[model samples]
Target: MPSHRAASLLLALSPCLIAQTPASPAPLDGIWLGTLHTGGPSLRIQIHLHQDAAGKWTCSLDSLDQNGVGIPCTLSSATNPIAIDIPAVHAKWSGSLTANTLDGTFTQGADMPLTLERQSTMTKPTPPATPDAALPPADATTIRAILDKDLAAALSSGALAPSTNAGVTIGVLAHGKRTIFTYGTAKPDSVFEIGSISKTFTGLLLAQMVEQKSVQLNEPVRDLLPPGTVAKPASGSEITLLDLSDQHSGLPRMPDNFAPADTTNPYADYDSKLLYADIAHHGVSIAPGAPFGYSNLGVGLLGSALANRANLPYNDLLHQQITGPLNMTDTSVVLSPSMRSRLIQGHDAAHNSARPWDLDALAGAGGIRSTAADMLTYLEAQLHPNQLPATAASTPQGKTLPAAILASHTIHADVPPGMHIALNWFRADATGNFWHNGATGGYSSFALFNPDKDFAFIVLFNTTISDKSFADRLGQHIAQRLAGDPAVSLAN
Candidate 1:
C-alpha cells in the first residue's frame, strides 16, 4: 500500500482510440473533470492540460477523493484520441476527444470507465494539514481504546466479513515502551504476509553491502548478474543498485512477459529463468535513474544480482544479513513448520479465500511474512539502531548495524508532491516521519515512526478490503493521537 494520497493517481491513457475521429481536433488545454467508477466508491478525477507556445502539451492529474493533486502525467499524444500515461502507478487512459467531453477507460490492473467533461473554470481544494511537529507523544491507553472500539465496530458491521478467522494486530512503541493489542482472532504471534515491507529488508541488505565495500551504489547491476545474462535499457545507462532501491530504474512496475499460470498465486511459478528471459528479451524503454516509477521488476532484479555477488540464495542472504542477526525468527520467505501452523488464511477484497504469494525470483519485492512481534522488533532496531544487541554482525569495514540502518533511512530521492524516498521507506517531508505499507492478495500492513518523537505504529490486517487505505489511515490516526494531536475518526 503506497500512500493512498500519493498512489491514487492511477490514470493512464493508451494509444487505442475510437474509430471515429473529429475532422478538426478540439484544443485539450484547460481543466477537465470526471468520475471514476472503481467498483466501490466513485472517485472524482480532475485533469489539467496545457499547451505551450511551442505547441507541446503537458498534463497533470488529481484524484480529489484521495487528496492526490498536481500529479504529473505524461501526455502521450495530442491527436483526436488523447493519450496519457502515469508511469508512477503503472496506469494509462485512452479516450476519444470531443468538443466538451473525453470518453475513455482507466487501465491499471483492471479497466474502469471514466468520462471527463471540460470545465470552464475550476478551484482546487486546500490540502490536508500536516501533523504538528511539537505535540507531545500520545497516551498508549487512549490509543488502544480508540483502536479497540473501531475494530469491534468494523467486525460487528460485517465490514470485515468472512470474519471467522479474521482480525487485526497492532503494535506501538512510544517513549521507550512497547505495547501490543489484538482484536478478533489475531494474536501477537499470528503470521501474516508483510508484502512490500520486505523491500525495506532488502534495502537494509543493500546498505550493509555498501557499508562493507562489497558493492558501490553506482555500480551497474549487470556486473553482478550471472554470466551471459544481459539487462540493459533500450537507451541511457544501465540500472544501478541505488536506482532500483529508490525506484528510479525506469523499469516498468512489472514485466510485460509475465503471464501467470495461476492467477490466485501469481508469483508462485515466476522463477529466475523467466525473470532473466524477460530482461534480455524486453529491455526497459526509459533510461535508468529517470523520474520515479514503481518497479517491482527492478528491485527483484537487484535482489537476484546481490545474491549472485554473494554466491548465496536471496532468502539465505536475507537471513544471514538482516533477520538472522536481528533474531527475527518468524520472518522469512520460506516458512518453517511452526510458522505454517500460525499462518492465517488470506481473503480477497470480497472476503473470499485468496492464496498466499510465493514471489520465487522476486522475493525481494514483496515476499516475506512475519508476526506483529517480529515487525515491532524490526521497527525497534530502526528507531534505536545504536541500541541493538552486540550479537548483531557488523560490516567487514567495521561499520555497525546502526550505521547501516541509518544509511538505509538516508533520503535518496523525491516521490512527487512532498514525499521523499529513503531506500524503500517513504519519508514525509513535513513531519520527518518514516513509513512504508505492504499489501498482498489477502493481507495489508502499515508501519510508521517518527524518530524525533520516539514513537512508532504498526498495523496488520488479515484481509484486503475494497478501500486500500484502511490500514494506512488507521496507523496514521494512531500516530496523530499519540502525538497529542486532535483525535480523528477511524471509520473506513
Candidate 2:
C-alpha cells in the first residue's frame, strides 16, 4: 500500500446561524453554562473558553461544584465538536444549534449512564475569575479520563460477554495539524472486526474499479454473471452493479437460498462456488433500481462481480486496490496469528461470557476486521474524497476518488431525525455529521467524518453499546466540548 496523507475532519464553517449566534455574545464567547438532564437527575456543567489573541476557541469544562467554584473537567472535542470521540473514556459527544438552544446529548462512557441536554442562553451571573492558571489545561490525558469512565461502563455493560475471554479494544485519533492523538493497546499491529465497515471499503473500491474501467457501475450484472445466473428481477434481465451497491437492485436483504453450513460463520461456508450457484437458482422479487431496502446480499453480489472482472480473489482485490494503496496493514478479510493475538477477546454480552460468531459467507457484507488506526486513514480518505490517489469527488474513476466518494456521502434517504443511510456509509446523529458503524457478536463500532468541514472520527467497542440512553448523553458531552468547529479543535 502506498502512503496516503490520512484525511482530517471537515473544515469548520463559522458556527451556523440556525439562529444568529447571540449578536452581542456575552461572557458567552468564553464561558458556556448549561444544565445536563440525565433523566434520573440533572447536573450543572460550566465550560470556560480560552481564546488566544487570534480568536481561536479552546474550552475547559467543570461539572458545577457545591460552592460553584468551576472545577476543571475533561470533556472531549472542545476543539472540534463534529469529530467527537474518545476511546480511553469509551464515549462520544456532539452538538447542534437549534431554534434557540444548543440541543445535544452525551452518551455514557464504559460504565456511565448517558445524559441529554439543551444548553442555551443562561441568565446566571458569571463567577469571579480565579487565576486561570490554577487549572491545568485539557489534553489527551483529560480526554482519556472522561473516555476511560465510559470504557469501564461499556466493559461492564455486557459489551464483553465471557463467551470470548477478551478485553474490549478501542482506538481513537484526534486529527490536529500539530499532532495526531491516538490511544489504544500498545500492541500496534492488532486486527479488529470492523464488521459492516467493510461496506465502506467495498463502496470505495467499487468506485476505484469504476475509475479503472475494470468494472462499470451501470452495466447489468447479467452481463458479467455467468449466463443463466438468476437474480430476483426476472422482468429486467439486467441489474447494474450500482444497483447492488446502492441497494436498489430490489434484492432481498438475505437471499432465499442463503442457508450456510456454518450459521455462526455464515459467509465462511459460501465461497464463490456457492455465491454463483445461489444466484443461478434463487430468483428476484422486484425490478432493478426499485425501492430502497438494505441488503447484505447486494454487497456480496457486487464484490463477486468485481472480483470476476478483476480476476483476483476478493480479499486480494481489496488489498491491491484499496487497503494496500492506503497502507492499512492491520485491515483485511483474513487475519494472521500475530495480528490476531492483539485482538481484544470479543465478548457476547456487556459483562457476560459469549463466543465469537463467524460470517465468512457474508464476506462482502461485513467480514472485514480492522483497528482504529487503520480506520483513521480510511476516515481521512473520506473527508478529502477529492484528494484520494485515483478517485474523484464527482467523476466515477481516475486519480483521486473525490467525486466518486462524494457521491457515496450524499443524503440518499432519511433513517431518523438526525440520521440517514447513503450507499454503505450513513450519517449518524449530528445534523451535519455523516458516518457509519458496525457490530460483530462482541463489538459495537462507529466511524464519522464530514468532508465539507475537513474533520473525521472513529469509535469501536467490543460489545453492543447502542442503547439510546448512554450514547445520547455521551454524544452531547463531546459536542459541547468540540462545538462543531473543526478548525478550532483541529486548526493547526
Candidate 3:
C-alpha cells in the first residue's frame, strides 16, 4: 500500500557527532519543526541545525511518526534559500528562510509542501484514542439495507465515480451467511489489487512455518538467508522473524537504493539480488522490538527468507501454504488467464486510467490481487477454522491449517490508542475487530471482521482517489451499523 501512514518511507538516522560549538549563537541554530501533509495522516518532521566555531553547519532530521531520529543530512547550501539533502533516503529540501521560519517543499518519492518553524522546545505527539461505542448486533437484512443506501448515495455524489467504468464490490459475512453487493461495473469475480493487505497473508505464512517447526519466532533472520548475508543491526541487536512480522525490525518502509526504471510499475525489476544488497548496505538501525514502525522492506525480506528456507519461489510457497488450502483460486501474485480476464481497469485520483503495479521481489509487501468473493471465503475460515476438513493437507511437519490461523491471530504487540497487532492484522482492543487495508497506484481495498459478533466486512475499489479515508470509513460505519449503533454518515 502506498499510503502516507504505512507505505511512506522514512530512514532511521544514526546519531550525529557534533563538533566543538562556538560561544556565539549561529543565526540558524535551533530545532525547526514542520508537518508533511500527506493526503492521509500528517507526519511531523524535525530538523536540528548547529554551527561550529569554524563556520561549518551540520543538520539532522527526525520523523516522529516513524520514530526515526538523529539522521544526519548533508547541507548542500547554507544561504537564504538553503538546500539540504538526505542522500540515504533520496529526499531533499530547499526552503527560503525568513526569520524563524523555513518554508519549502520536501521531495522524496513525491513532492509535498513543508513549512518548518523554529521551536523553543520539542513537541511530543499524543496518539488518538479509538472510539469505544458499544454496538448492538443487527441482522443481515438491516446491514444490507444500510450499506446499499450508502453506496447509492456515494455514487450519486461522485464519491464512487468516474461513473463510466468505475466499480466497487462489497462482501459481508453475518451470522455465518455471506452476502455480496456490487455497484457500477463490478461483479462477484471482479479482481482488484489488494496492496499491503498482502502483508497479512505473509504473516500467516510465517505463523504456519513456526507451527510446523520449520522456523522459530525468535530465530535470527540471517539463518534463513543465503550464507554471508548481513541481517544484524549495527547496534548489535539481532532481528528475528517475529521482529519482522511485528514491524519492529527497524527496517525502512522502502529500501534507500530503490531506483525503479518505471515509476508506474515500480517493483517489477527489484529482484532478490537487489533485496539482499539493500539488507547488506543498510542494516537495521533501531533495536528489534522497539517501537512499531511499519516497514514494507522488513516484511518483503521475511517472505524472501521464508521462500529460501522452503526452496520455492514466493508465489509457489504462498500457494502451498495459504491460498491453496483456502481454495482462494482468484487470490495470487501472478494472475492466471482467468484472473486477468476478470481484472478491472484501475483509475488514479484524477479518474484517469492507471497502470497496475508489479511488486516483483517485494511482492509480499503489497502484491496479491483478489476478488471480494475469494476474500470473504478467506475471512470465513478465520472466523471458524474448525470448519476446515480434518483431512486437509498439513505443512511438512504436520501442522493443520486451523492451528496456523489461530496462531496468526494471537496478539504479539501493542499499537497505541487501544489497539493490538496480531501478526500483520490490526485489532481494536475495545471492539475486538481485526482489520487491514491496502492500496496500490490505482486501487484500494479494506477487510475487517469481528469474530465475537460473527461478522466480517470486505470492500474493494478499482480506483484510487484523493479521499484516502473513504473505504476505511465506510467499513467502520458498516461495522458500527452491524453492532446496531447509529449509522455514521458516509464520507462523500
Candidate 4:
C-alpha cells in the first residue's frame, strides 16, 4: 500500500502543518461519557470518536460495568447526526446530535425498545483507540460482585423474588461437549421441570416420524387419533401437526377441557379423559394456517396423536426415542426416586411452599424435567445437527435416528416478527438460535442456543405465572441477556 501523500508531506513540513492545525477540534471527537438505557437494564459508558479526511468516521463504546471496555463499530451517518452499532452486543445506538443535546433510540434485545438521553455531565468523546476486549482485571471481579448486588437490589425492590426468582445460567459447548459457567441450584445435577419446553420433544418425535414417512406434516391429525375417539365438530378433521407446530391450528392457548379448579397448579387437574373428549369435539376456531394464536392445546393434542401412531404411551415413546438415546438420565415424565431426591424445591414470591405438577393430559406439551447440564447437551445436538453422536456411531447400511431429529428441529412454519416454529423448537430468525421455555406448577425455565455462536443459556426458577404477558416478558428478557445484549439487566 502506498503511504498517504498528506502523511508524508506533514512529516516533511512539520512546522507548516502545525501552523494550520485547528486550534479547537470538532466537539464530537473526544472521550465522551454516556449511559445506555435498556429500560429494565442500564449501563454507563465511555465512548471514543474519530473522523477521517473523507468524512468517514467510527465510534466505539466502553461500559462502566465492563470498566471502560470498548468495542469498535462503524458510525453510520455523522455529517448532520451520529449513529453507533455495537455488533458484539447487537445494540444499535442512533440519534440526533445538536449543539446542546443528543437524542436517539437504543435497541438491545426483544424485550422492549428504549429511548436514551445524554447524562447531565456527559462530554464530547475522545480520539478513537484500540478498544479493550474484556473487563478490567479488578472490574471483572467487580462485575460479579455488582451482579450479586444488583440482583439483591432488584429482589429487595420487588423486581425479583428472593428464593423463587427466575434466573439465567450461561453455558458453553465445545467439540460435542458442554460446560456450565454458573448453575443456579447448588448442585449441577439438579433438575427443573421443562414445561412447554417439552413441546420441542413432541415436535421432534413428529418430525422424526415424518422423516421416516410414518407420518405426514400436512396429514390430518384425525388420522393419528386412537380408534373409537369421540367427536362433535365439523372442522376437527382439518387440524394437523403443521398447524399445531405453527401455532395456527385455530386452537385457544389452552383447551376448555382444562377446568383447573385450582388456578395455582392448572395442568395438575387436567386428565386424559378430558383431553380425549375435548379433541373429539374439536371445532377449530379458525382455518388452518391462519392467524397465530399460541395454544398449549395444539401441542398437547399433537403429542397425544404422536403417541397413538406408535401405539405406545407418550412417556414411553418420549423416553425410548429421544431422552434414552440422548442419555438425558434425569429428564422424564415421572420422577424417579433418585431424581426426586435431586429435585429442587419450588417456591412462590413469598418463598412459601409450592405444589408439584403433572401434565398428564398433555405430558408431551409440558411434562419434562432436565438439568442445565443436560439442556446444554440437547442444545448442542440442535446446533450441530449433522455431527450428532448418533451419526458418528451409526451402523453402515442401517438406520440412524440423528438425521430425523435434525430434520425435526429445522424450521417448519413461520410465527411472527422474525420468528419461525420448528418441530418443538423456536427459531430466532436466521441467527440459528433454537429454544423453548418451560413453566411447571411453580417453576419457570428457559433454554436457548445459537448454532452459529456455540452459545447456549438456561434460566430456571421456582416461580411461575399463568399470565401470558409475564411469561413472555420473562422469556424475552432472559434471551436478550444471554444473546449478548447486556442492556437486559434483571430476569425480572
Candidate 5:
C-alpha cells in the first residue's frame, strides 16, 4: 500500500525523580547519564550535546526506560535556564547548566524535577548494527537449504530478478521445533513491512473490542462516525463493523482523496482530515455484504472506528488489546530506533532500492513492521489462543482470546471451492489451514499455520516479488513439508 519509513520511538515518561545523581564536571557537551526515579520503576536518562564546526549547539534525549532513542528537539537559550523542546512527544525540559550538572524540570503532559550529571565516558550503548553477513544460525534445519534452492529457482525464473535485490528470512515450525533460515542480508531480528497482515491484527482488535462490549460488531457504520457525518451506500443499506471486517462494506481499495506527496511511499501524507473528507464525500460502490470484495478502505475504516470507539489511537489500542499481551514487542506501527536499526532495506523486483511506506491515518490497512521472530510468536499465540491472558491486568482488553481467535479464523465467506475468507484471514477449508499474505512496495510476506497438524511457517522477503501467489505457494510448501502431507500443497 505504501513504502516503509523509519520512525523515532516515543518513550513512556512518568513525572517523578527519586534518585540521586553523581556529580561531575565533564562539560554537559558529551553525554549526561542519570536515572529518573519515578513512582514506579527507575528510568535511565541520557542527554547528549554537541557543537558543530559553526559552533551551533545541538542536543537530544534518550529515555532508556521507555526504549526511546535520539528524540529530536530544539534547544532554547544556551546560557542559564536552558530550554529543550521535544514537540514530537509534547515534552520539554528546562534546567540551568552548572559546571558539571544541570538541574531542571521535564514536562510531558506533566512536570517532573530532574538532575543530569555529565558521564565519565561517552559510551552509551548504540542501537544494534546490521548483521555483518546473511547466514542462518548454526542450528538451521534442512529446510534452509531446500528453501534456498526454491528461492534460487524463483530467481532463475526471472520473476524475482525484475524487481528484487533484497533478503529473505524463513522459518518452519514443525513438531514443536523451529528452524530459521536467512538469505541475502538478513538476520533473525531484521524487520520487514507485513502489509495486510496488519488487517489480521485489526480483525483481532475488533474481536477484543466486541468482546469487551465497547463495540458492537453489527452496529451501523453511521453510529460509529462523528455526529452528522455521512457514510452511506447507494442501496440505502446500512454498513456494519462486521461488513468492514468481512470485506463486504463496498468501500474502494483506497480513499479517493489519497494524493500522496510521494507516489513511491504513498500513504505517508494521508491524515485523518483527508480520510474523513473522503468518507464524507464518498458513496458506496456496491450494496453492503452483497459479495466478497476485498477492500483496504473498509478495513482501515474499521480500525479507525474502533479507535474512535475506544478513544485511543489505532497503535495504542493495538498495544493494549493484542501485542502487549502476546509479547509481540517488535510488532508496531512506529519503529523504535532499535527496530529501525534492524530493518532490512527493501528492493524492487528490478533489484533497485525502494523507499519505505509510512502510514498517517490508515495504519490498519498496512502499517505494521515486524520481524520473523516476533511474527512466529504471534502465530504461536494464535495457535494457542487460550494462552492469552483472560483479561489484561491494566486494561479490559483480554478475556476473549479464545472467542476472538475463533471468530477471526471462522469462515465468513467462500472465495471458491478451496479458499474461504474469514476476519481478514483466508482459510483453506479443504486442508484445514488458516493463513494470510501481505505485500508492500518493497516487501512480500507469507504467514500460515495449520492448527490441526500443529504446524506453521512465516516467510518474509525484503523484495517486491510482485507475486503474492508465489509467496503463498512457498508458504504452502513449507506447511506441507512440516505436516508431512503433500496432499495439502497447492499446484504451482
Candidate 6:
C-alpha cells in the first residue's frame, strides 16, 4: 500500500511508463509543419525527420517565420510521446504522435502549444560557396596596416568558420575624399545582410509619416492597428510610435512564439497574423513608455503600423520614402538576381556555413541587405545632407526628410554616459556622433559618422564570429584617425 503522496507520484509516472511501451515505430521520417501559439506571436514551425540505416534518428527544426532552417536536433523514441531536442537553441518538443500527425508543445524558456502535420514534399538546400564573381584583390591602402593585421589574425584564430575565406570591406568618407578597401573574399560590390540597422530606416519612416501628419509619434499605437486588433496591456500608459522607435516600447527582445523551425533563416514565415497575435497576447511587460529596453518587437511593430497607415508594405514604403530617392539601388529587403550573384557566403562563429535570414513580418527589425559601395553612398548623404537633391530633403510624397533627419538625430533617451538613443540612431551624447551596428546569424555590420567633421566609415563582414569585432575596431580606428585624433582608443 502506497502513501497518498507516493500514489500521486506513481500516477504522474504512469503516463511516461505508458508512453514508453514502444508502440509501433511511427514512420516519422518526413516534413512536418506546425504552428506554435503563444502569448505573444504564433510561430510557423517545421521539422524534417530521417532515420539512418544504423537505426539512429535525426531531426532538423525550422521556424518558417524566423528565417531559420536545418537547426540540428535529435529525436527520442520513435513511438507516441516522442521527444525532440535541439541543444543548439536550448529548445525541446514533447508530444504524442498519432498516425501522420504530431500534437505537442515546444519549449525554450517558455511553453507554447504546437501541432505538426506531415507533408510529402520538401526540398533540400544547396551547399554554400563563395561567389564566383568575386573580384581580384584590390588596394587596401586606406585600411590601417595594424587593423589589417588584426583582421588577418582574427580570421585565422579559429573563431570564424574554418577553411572559409572570410573577410571585410571597409568604406570611409572624410574631408571631401572617399576610399574603399577590400580584403579576403570581399569586393566593393559584395553584398551582406545589414541586420538591425534596418531599424534606423523604420525610424526615418516614422519621422516621415509624422511630418506628413499621417501618424503621430506620441499617440497610442492602437490607433494605427485595425480596431480591436491589439489588446492594450494593463499598463495604463499607451505605447507610442516614438516609444517604439526609441527602443522603449516595453516589448520583449523577441516574442514568446519566436521559436524558430530553422535557426538559420529565422524570420521567413512570421506573418502579420503572428505579429498581431503576439501583441494581443502579451501587451507590454513594463509600462508602455518605460525606460530604455531594446526590443526587436517594438521596432517591427512600428514598421507594420507605419505600413498600415501608408497603405503599403514596409519595403515599398521604405523605397518610396528613402532608398529610391537616395538612389540606394543596392539596399533592399530582397536581393535582385544580379545582387544574388554577388552575394558573399556567410559563416557562423564555429566555422559552419550559416543560412541567410529572411524577415517576412519582421523585416523592419532587420531585413535589408546591402553592399559597401552603396552604404558609402548612404554615408555620404548622411555626412553632407546639403549634397542631396533639393527634393531629397522633402519627399514629394508626405515624408519630410529634413524634419525626419532632425527628429532621428535628436536625443530621445539617456543610455550610458557615452551613448543615447535618437530615434533608431545611437548617438554619442559627448561628441554628437551617430553610429549603429547590425548582426545576423552569419554576418555583422557597423556604420559610424560625425556630420560636423564630415567623417564616416562603413564596415561589412561575411562572418558573425566573435572576431567580427574587428570591424568595430577598424571602423573606430579609421573614424578617429580621420578626425585627427588617432590616439583615442576604441576600447574607450
RMSD in order of candidates: 4.8, 15.8, 8.4, 16.9, 20.7, 15.8
Q: What tens-digit string does per-residue lDDT give for candidate 6 at 296-380?
A: 7888999998988889988899888888777788899888898898888886644457888889888998889998878887777
Candidate 4 lDDT, tens digit per residue, 1-492? 000000000000001101122232235655555454432334445556767686545565655443334444445446444555443232455655544344454533111222333344434333323322332222112333434543554455443544434443434453444555332433566667767788887887887677667788988777787666754244434777788776667665556566777755667778778887887776533453365455677888888888888888888887666776666777788888988997777654334556777777788878887777777767766776555555334432114456776677667676544567777676767456776666555566667766666555555555553211123333444444334343223432
Cα deviation in Å at residue 63, candidate 6? 30
Q: Pick the winner on TM-score between candidates 4 and 5.
A: 5
Clashing pairs in 3: 13-71, 136-483
Candidate 6: count of backbone clashes, pairs at least 3 residues apart or interchain: 27
TM-score of each: 0.82, 0.59, 0.77, 0.63, 0.66, 0.67
* Candidate 3 residue lDDT tens string, 1-492: 111122223211122222232243236888889876554455688888888997667777776764445554656557756777652233577767776677776754334567787899876544433433445565555666756665675777655654636788889888888888887768888999998789899999898898888999988888899988785554666888988898767676677688888877778999999999998887644553465556788899999999999899899989888887777899999999999999999876546677988887888888899999889988988898878534345544223678888999999997643667888888888788888877676777788888898898788987653332355556666777787765445534
**Full candidate order by TM-score, most accurate first:** 1, 3, 6, 5, 4, 2
Strongest candidate by TM-score: 1
lDDT of 1 by residue, 144-246 (tens): 7655654554667644433545678888887777888887668888899987778898888888888878888888887887777775554666777899899
User: Candidate 6 regions off by >4 Å?
Assistant: 1-162, 232-235, 284-289, 390-399, 465-468, 484-492
Question: Cα miss at 190, model 6 (Å)?
Answer: 0.7
Better-scoring candidate (TM-score), 2 or 4: 4
Residue range 118-154, candidate 5, lDDT tens digits: 7866545444323122223222256676455546645
- How does candidate 3 fare on TM-score? 0.77
Which structure is stronger by TM-score: 3 or 4?
Answer: 3
Query: Any runs in candidate 4 off by more than 4 Å, and if so which?
Result: 1-170, 174-177, 181-185, 230-237, 261-264, 284-288, 390-399, 430-432, 465-485
**Looking at candidate 6, what is the lDDT of residue 17?**
13
Off by over 4 Å in 5: 1-142, 148-164, 231-235, 284-289, 389-395, 467-470, 485-492
Q: In model 3, state the lDDT of residue 296.
A: 80
